[model samples]
Target: MSDTTNHQRIIALEAENAALKARIASLEARLQLNSAPPQSLTHTTPTATPELSAEEYLRYGRQLIMPQIGLPGQLRLKNTRVLIIGIGGLGCPAASYLSSAGVGTLGLLDHDLVELSNLHRQILHTLAYIGRPKVLSAIDRLRAANPNVTYIPHITALDKENALEIIQNYDLVLDCTDHPRVRYLVSDAAVIAGKTVVSASALKTEGQLVVVNKPTSSEEGGRGPCYRCYWPRPPPTESVVSCGEGGVLGPVVGVMGVLQALEAVKIISSGALEGQRAPASANEAAAGSPGTEGPSKPEPASMLFFSSYSPTPFKTLRMKGRRADCISCGTPSDPALKITASTIPDYDNFCGPGPDAVLLDPKDRRTVMEVGEMIGRENVVVVDTRDETQFGITSVGGSRNVPFVLWQRGGKVPEEFWRAVEEEGNSADPQEEGEKGKGTKGKEVVILCRRGNDSQEAAKMVMEDPRARDWKVTDVVGGIGEWARKVGGVVEY
Candidate 1:
């Protein structure tokens, strides 16, 4: 062959080699993904005796050696099934530990998809799985961590219709969700299904945990108190804050999640299941009769509070056992409190409606487009009601910072804010303004915040104040987030 022909062949061969490498990489990734537990293991039938493989023995050897969780406890873990709801911050660590400890079956249930914001605290999900269902992402990580364990993914929210049916299959349920309605729903469903629940929540450097509806003999006060026994009514919608709104430290939530796993593992190995007994010292075993129960005692109903900033980070509040008057767990003569699938109360109604963005009349609310026009106009005064930190992050130019918290505390707008408004009103060019520049009527006060809800509240407060009777008070319809999307000037965060 000629030299030119040989050079052309060399280039073609190099291109072919690159294509083959890419194909090999793709196949390897597929094999790794498919190497997870078989389809049969997804719904493994529990046998009377669950035997562990040699690989599992080595995998869980560290935890198995502990006297608290020896051979018997390991087998109990092999047979126990746990369902974790809301695979976000708390669920991520809790599931990781449980699967690593060799729990036979884990049910991962979540309705949300993985977002970029969830990665800091939701440890199981990564950048690769963003926009995917959280449960599927969690399953991928969990299966890789412990292939011996069975993982069942429920890629849907737990509602009254399906909560009981799904919860019935698991020995225990973890209420890792952040919302109040879901918490109540989980507790009610767990109570109805006769399952124990380890519920936990974390936000803003603080976390709270509780194990409720623990299965007990008739003598043990007919099972511990359900969540309703402690708080029958949900907190006011305004009082409840989410992680997105209030913010949370990543480690604070991770700590709460790890503790939840610890509680779950303890519950499983505590002789609560058939053919399993809490391990005892040799002396105690020798002293007791053959039929005598082991030293396992029911953990008293209690709430554990953790604050990362506090010197005493952990505090336990002992709670009363089940109440006779509890609407859900009670023996009230009224039958309406009892919740079944068909009788489950509408949680949205029970919790009350969420914040109303349209609380004010149309005339009193201005859209972001209108606000964009008003920016830098001396006659229009924009007051940002978000906190100082948020105000510093990104804000409309010439807008005054008057946080909503001041209004929430029943305080009037500060003198500085009025001074700024007065300066803006005085600086208006009468000749340039025309008819609108007549008297204080020319000045307009526009309220804005992170979201429109707080601005509406603040606008109402400002309107009610006697000081600004002549001024036009209105709030931006969708606040900074809307402005960021529509106008592209301010940062939404």
Candidate 2:
């Protein structure tokens, strides 16, 4: 060949070589034999609905017969995983029902030990298990109710450190804890984990129930309003009362807890209606993988309030959906306000200072022993701030009943009521010089109730009143319950 012909032929051969390399690369991609991992196709894998065994059919026949809950609903319940964060009054009843109803996996978490006092409301912890870790005690009782159900007992407290990880493992969470600080933590952690929360609280004869962070629509970026959406800030320290202090009716908490399970069943069943069936493997659901799931379900009522004493019980409140400015569930107003595992705010601070921190002023409080010592002092006056019924049930020997509600009315109560209260305490000590005693006449006022919480709040009210400003006012620390325990059980609880 000539020099020019040979050059052209060389170019053609190089081009052919390039085409062969391109074909080889294409074949490698098709077979996924290259170094890079193959891309997954974007599609949902449908979860199959599980069927009931012969024994399961007979055991759940009553519920299965209901139209709202048939085989499909039962299967959904069997597939759903729930975590109950406290095994106290609310947790006991909630765990009981959820287990019997056949929830696939139930997680019971609590750091507290069972106590004698808990027997009245914490039904899951029995005399046999007293002094044991609450989660262990609760799990024992639950397993007896339904041995087939799997139970996960977390003996440690749920805090920011373990909350997100634990929460992400379950499909739903139950905020059965009594602490206000934990309530906010559970809600925030659930929001971050992309799970829904069912929360219930009971004190005295009243109870409240709410579902938080439920998905409103698959198209919506975030779930519905969270706990902070309505209660953007925690209630004032004095406004909260523990069941231990305030005293709850076991049946009242029982009612709320049972209803909490009902709400969970409803939430889970609604998903089945939308064709979001249970995963074939329990491991997949517990891992919270969207491995095989369908669209989200609308949330139930925003809130429910039940009072055993009310003429009409069980009031449902409608929600206004998610707030545009919600701190946890909304689009952040400030870029720095975003909440993540690392960015969760100090829950204690977000819930505000607790009662213990708020009542640190020396002049504002008296110990139970100090108040008990004042019982017979001629000049010291005791005011029982509980309602007439509670005061009648138990009270200090000589303390006069002045319902806290009358004082909280903020001048709505007649001036004569205060005068009468003061007069009762200042009854004439005939031995004193009339004019001299009258000048420094006001009695040192010590306010007390069942627990110190209400008494502290009442004491602050008394100190703020212009009419009582001259009075040296203080709350009884630990209130009558403490006084009873420390001072020979003089007061009834």
RMSD of each: 11.0, 18.1
lDDT of 2 by residue, 190-272 (tens): 88887889999998889999888876663256366888887877775545666765678999999989999988888776562
Q: Which ten residues in a row have the lowest lDDT in candidate 2?
A: 41-50
- TM-scores, all candidates, are 0.79, 0.75
Of the candidates shown, which would achieve the greatest TM-score relative to the real structure?
1
| Whole-model lDDT, model 2 | 0.72
Task: Please report how far candidate 2 places residue 220 from its true position, in Å.
Answer: 2.2
Quote the lDDT for 159 in model 2.
80
Mind giving the per-residue lDDT tens digits that candidate 1 earns over 359-426? 78899999999889878765688989888888899999888888777766655666656665665666
Which residue pairs of candidate 1 clash? none
Residue 321: error of model 2 in Å? 1.3
- Write out the backbone clash pairs for model 2: none
Candidate 2 regions with alpha-carbon error over 4 angstroms = 1-57, 64-72, 203-205, 272-293, 296-302, 307-312, 355-358, 361-366, 411-421, 430-443, 457-474
